[model samples]
Every structure is written in C-alpha cells, then in structure tokens.
Target: MSVREATPVTASTEPPPPALRASARSRRRRGGQWWVPWLFLAPALVLFLYFKFIPMGQAIVMSVQDVKPYLGSTWVGTANYGEILSSESFRSATWNTILLAIGQTGGSMALGFGLALLVEGQTRKLSFIRSAAFLPVVVPMAVVAELWRIMYHPTSEGLLNQIIGLVGLGPSGFINHPDTSLGSIMLTGIWRGAPYDMMIFLAGLAGIDRGLYEAATVDGASTRKRILHVTLPGLRPVFAILFVLAAVRGFRSFTEVFLLTNGGPNGSTEVVMTLIYKLGLEQNRLGVGSAGAVLLFLATLVLTICVQLLRRRRSA
Candidate 1:
C-alpha cells in the first residue's frame, strides 16, 4: 500500500473579510442609537412633566395643606376634603354634574344615531349636508355659547322665541330663568356634541358588514328591524366609547358654563368644574379646591375603569 502525503494544518489568522467588519460596525451603531426615539419624545415628555404632572403633584400636596399663597401653607390632613364634602354648594354641584352627564350623553347619542342614518350614503348631496351638520362641532365652544346666548335672549324677538311664536307659544326664558338654566345649557351641549358623535357613528356604520343588511332585507325585515338587529348590535363598541367620552365631556364642562351662566341665577347651573373655579380662584381656598379636584380625578378614574370592566365582561 502506498502512503499518502499529509497536508500541513494552519489556523486562519487573517482578519474577517471587510464586509463582515462593516456589518459588525453597522450593528454597533444601531445599538448605540437606541435612544433616538426617546430623543424625539423628549419635548412632549418635558411639557407634560412641567404643565400636567408637576401641577398634579403640587395639587395633591396642596390638598392636604391650607395654601396661603405668599404666606406658608399649613398642613391640615384631609380637613380640606372634609370641608368640601360637607359644603352645600359642593353637594349641589355634584348633583348637577350627574344630571348634566346623563342628559348630554343620552341626547347626543340619540341625535347622532339619527343623523348617521339620514346621511349614510356616498353621494355629493349627502356629503354636503353631513358637512353642514358638522359645522357646530368645528365652531369653537365659546362661539357656540355666544350664539346660543343670543338665540336664548328671553324676549319675543329672540330667534328661538320667534320660531316658537309661529306656533302661538309665548316667549320662554331659557338660560335666564333658574327653572330652565340647567336644561338650556344641557341642550346646548347636546347640539354641539351630537355632530362629533355622528361622525363616530358613521365610522361604525361603515365597518358593519353590508351583507348582513342585504340578508336581512332578503328576509323581508323592515328598516327598523334591520337597524335594531344588525346596525345597533354592530355598533356596540362605538356606543361604549361614545358614552364614556360624552360623560367625561359633560363632567368637565367648564368653558360653556363659565361663559354662559358662571354658576349664577341662584347657582342652579352650578357643576363641579364651576364650583372648583369658585373655590380656587374666587374664594382663594386653594386647599379645598385641590381636594375637590382630587375627588373629581378619582371619580373620573373610577368611571373609566368601571366602563372598561363592563366592556370586557360583555365581550367575554
């Protein structure tokens, strides 16, 4: 047998090819730039920290102390909360807030659902009308309040009064009268808020399966039956979201009440936001105001959590 010559063994001491080195460097550069997204987020973070979080922290601290402005604040340990709870005005404000939230949420959703039904089409005319109807939403709340204030002028010549007069109804005091003040404000809210709700409903309607409607029609289902069985069931998620949003908006209603009534005419229209303003700025009772704010925050948090839990349960 002939013996084969053995090849010499050697380790590969040469560097990795240039392509491998470039790829390694690129990966290192990417790892080092991991903070790029955070850098972009820094401005918003700073603003929220200064304007929102810092103020919230200060308010929480002040809730336990009697804020004396130029003078030193004195710690009172929930005394402010006690005072707020016991106050008659605060009680009234809480009741009014609940009433307004219910009224606005229901009214807006009803009106919006109706409007969505009327304009659920892909025609120029329908689109134009929908846009026109949504004008109230785009108009600033301040302007809406001012415009309604004029319409509700509580005189024979007032816009609403004139229209009612055509039907032989007498001039009615709207926001001007204590008996009707809260209702009038609530109506204003509903009118402005309905358009936003309408937009959401339109989006929801678009998401519904068109085949469902066709199948129902083929089964000789009436329009109302189709809506009840098909449209309403499909829009459950939209309804849930709209309810929360409308409720929160109603509870946070400040600009409209402040500009329109300012919690006046015997405080009939006084809501929690107006009450807080009165306590904090008008009365200079910062501690009490802070406590009220904290309570409001907690209430809102509870409401959101309850809604979420309910939604999850329903889905399950």
Candidate 2:
C-alpha cells in the first residue's frame, strides 16, 4: 500500500480526554454528598415532628371526643365544632379578634418600619434605640398586661387618664367603655410589639445594597420615590415574614385579653383564645375547647400558607 493510504481516516467520534473523564467522576462523587443536607436537617425534622406535628395530631384527636371526669369519653364527631360555629358569643368574639389583629398588625408594622428607616444608617444611635425598642419584647407579656391594665384604669386615678386630665380631656374610660376597651388593648399590643417589628425591618434594611439607593440618588429620585420604589421592594421578604408572625400572634393572643378584660364589657373584647379558656376551664368542656384550638390552628395555617404563596408570586 502507498504511505498515504496506509494512514486510515480518523473517525469523527473520539473518547473523552482523561481530564474531562476525571472531572466527571469527581462531580459524581461530590453529588453523592447530597445526603449531607438531609443529615443536617434531621434534628429540625425530629423536633418539628415531636413538638409541633405530634401535638397537633393529638389536639385533632381530642377535638372529636367528648371528655367528662366521671363519664367515659365518647366520640361526638362535629358536634363541638357546630356548637362553636353557632354560638353568638363565638361570632362576636371572632369579629373582635379580627379587629384587634388588624389594628395591632397595622400599627406595629407602620411604627416599626418608620423607626427602622429613622435609625437605619446611624450606628451609635441605632444600638440605643434598638435596645430600648426590644426591651418591651423581653418583658413578660403578663407583666405588660398588668402594667397596661393599671394604666388603663377607668377612673381619673389611672395613669393614662391622669395624663389626659392634665391635657384637659377630663376622665375618659379607657377600658371601662366597650367602645374603647378593645382599642385600648390593641394599643398596648402595639406598644409591646412595635419594637420586634422594628428590629426585623432594621435587619432587612441593613442587608439592602447601598448601591441601589446611590443609583436612585444619582437619577435625582426624591426620597419618597426612592423609598416607594427601592426600599419597599427590598423589604418585601421581611414584610411577608413579619406579617405572618404578627397575624399568628394576634390570633393566638390570650394573656393580655384574659388579664385586662377577661372577655368582659358585654363580650366586646372577647377573642377565640379567651373563648377557649372559658370553655375548657370555666365550663369544663374540654372537647369543645380542643375543637376551638384545632380550628384556630387550621385557620392560622391557611393564613400562613396564603402569605407564603403570595410572596412567592411577588418574587416571581
């Protein structure tokens, strides 16, 4: 054969280079470490199952059973649920709770976001203000309720009324009047909760890129315009988280209502938690109370899920 013909034509397909093959093998080995994430997550999964999921399951089971001290427990199906749903007291309490939640959540979020903006860039002053704001959060809720109760006393001897008197508003019934009792409780809740919201917002604000603000300023954006466009967008995640948290807190609230009003003043300040307390403790209707708790839990779960879905849509 001629020398040129002796060299066979090279095929188009060739084996991968050794380095490429080695890299592929290495990636496969590394990908096997996916179990690392699950391993790390195991503790949290266990805790959630034990504390949250298990208790919820138990509550659901208890909700369906009629429990009596002397009489044996019996399954009553949806009877307890129907009772709460049909009761006039439950309807009024539901309305009161919704109002309280709206007032508390709105007031706290607005006040907190404002405070966060005010202190965002000031390192020295931020520490002092943050500490002062968070101090109320650390105080026991019971103590806060007691303190506010004293301040909300209906008589002129009350601290709040005394202050109003100094301003010539005369003695106003802060908690005595049904018209004002729920509102007064909401004010105290706002006072205690604003600091926590402020801290969350402050953290979010701190993490926001300074370049965005600088770019807006370079474009001659007004402060309000920059806040409307940049700051709010940056805060969307924080806002979602805070909103869910505040809603849950508002729904499950009991200590303050119990201590301050005890669902009194013609049931104007009554809420689901207080209602549950009356059912379980006073009326000794354990099954009914359990049902109420289960309903509340389900409601909270639905709200939280809705908020999360909305946030995901916004982000997308």
Candidate 3:
C-alpha cells in the first residue's frame, strides 16, 4: 500500500471534556441565578431612586431658581447661592452647626461606648438597663426638646434650677443664656442619640468571637490589652458607620433646636437646618433655602466618602 494511503487519520475534532462542559453548564446556571439577586434588589433600588435620588436632583435644580411667594419660580442662576454664602446669618449658622456636630457626635459616641463596655458581659439586670438606655431612641425628638425646655427654664421653677438651688448654686438659664444655649442643645442631642450608638456597639460586641478572648487570656494578656488588641479591631467597622451616621444626624439637627430654643438668645443656638427652615418657610426664600440644603448635602457626601475610604483602608 502507498505510504499516504497506509497512514491512519487521527481524530482531531472531539467533544469538550466532561469537566469543561460541566463548567460551561454551571456558568449558565449562575447566569440564571443572577436574576434572583436582581429581583430581590429591585424594590429597594426603585425606592431609593424615587425617594432619594430624584429629590436630590430636584433640590439641585431648585437651588438655582428664585421662587417667590405666590409667584412661580424664575431661573436666576447662582444668585441664591451667592446670597446664602455671603450672609452673616449663614456664617453664624454654619459655625453653630459645626459646633453641634462635633459636640453631639463626640459626646454621644464616647458615652455610648463606655456604657456598652460596662454592660458587655452582664446578663440579668443589664437587660433592663439596656432597655432603659434605649428608651430615649423611641421618644420623639420634639417631645424630648419640649421636656428639656421645661427642665431648662430660666426661673427657679425649672427642675434643673431647683436642683442647683439645693446645692446653693444660683439659678442658671440653661437654654436661655447665650453662652449655655448651644451647649445645652448639644447635651440634649447627646442624651437622645447615645442610646442608638450604645445599641450598635452592643451588637458589634456580641459578634466578636470569644475564642480571641480565651486565647488572649491564655497568653496572660490584661483586660485593657485584650480590648485594645482585639475588641477595638473587631469594632472598627461599626465605629466607622456609627460615627458617620451620628455626624450627619448632628449636623442636620433641626426639630430639637427649633422646639427648645428656636435659635434664640442672639441666635447662639442657630444651626444650618434652622436657617434653611427660616429661609424657606418663614422668609419665603426657597432659593436660598435650597442652597443651604445643597451645601449640607455636599458636606454629608464628603463625610460619607471619607468614612468609606477610611473603612476600605482599614479592611485592606
């Protein structure tokens, strides 16, 4: 036979191996499963778009328009923003807002974390204490403000003043005095918000693996050392989230300030939110109010971004 004819032809074309075929089938299955997550996420995404993103877009548009009372808005690009930034009231309000944010956020987080640490291992009576700590969170802000206002009244009839009088201290107008008004408002905010932070910290503490504590104990680690090395590391994410949330809430505080002091005592308690409310509702200057809102939005955005970046860095 001729050599060419005698040569057997080998099969070059073959079906994919079983593993490759199974992998391809698995990928297709995964593609089908992708819709499940999307389906679950659709409702939340729609709500976010409708409520958050759309309102933000509208606010940005409104910031540039001059909306007169009883007359429709007219486009006056950037004029409202200029006026808002240049106004003395805006400057003072911004300062007060910053002070409130710093005081409330720092004070609440510190007190809450301390309380969480104290109650971390307790089981019986601590549960009742925890509930008591969290009760303020359920109370409405307006009600808390009004309650504090009565307690902070400038007269001898005030609860705080009566207590001070028992100690031979002169009655101090806690909420009416310019020097004390901002601080008093900050204290109220801290009292109202600390419970939430405490709860968050408690949840984070509960999630920590007990094995780490046991291992540290075996290594003769002190309680403070264990906390510094283990507990704090475990709580980093919770702390970051809580701090950002508290900062945002404190910065936007309005109802409490409005109900308690109405930015009184020479505007010592004035905050950005109160200014925005006055500009929009009282003065009928929607454009200026929108500008203040936009500024607050930007500040919050910046803070959120910074927190996210810090979290990523810590995780890495």
Give me the candidate number with maximum TM-score: 1
lDDT of candidates 1 onward, in order: 0.95, 0.90, 0.93
Q: What is the alpha-carbon lDDT of model 1 when measured against the actual structure?
A: 0.95
Residue 189, model 3, lDDT? 95
Give the Cα-based TM-score of candidate 2 against the true structure.
0.84
Best by lDDT: 1
Candidate 3 lDDT over 21-55, as tens digits, reads: 99999999998898898899999999999999998
Per-residue CA lDDT of model 2 for 23-105, tens digit only, reads: 99999988988798899999999999999999878778878989886888899999989988898988888888888888999
Best first by TM-score, ranked: 1, 2, 3
Candidate closer to the true structure by lDDT (higher is better), 2 or 3: 3
| TM-score on alpha carbons, each prediction | 0.88, 0.84, 0.84
Query: What TM-score does candidate 1 get on C-alpha atoms?
Result: 0.88
Across 1-316, the per-residue lDDT of candidate 1 in tens digits comes to 9999999999999999999999999999999999999999999999999999999999999999999999999999999999999999999999999999999999999999999999999999999999999999999989999999999999999999999999999998999899999999999999999999999999999999999999999999999999999999999999999989998998898888988999877999999999999899999999999999999989988998999899999999
lDDT of 1 at 98: 93
lDDT of 3 at 151: 91
Q: lDDT order of candidates, best first?
A: 1, 3, 2
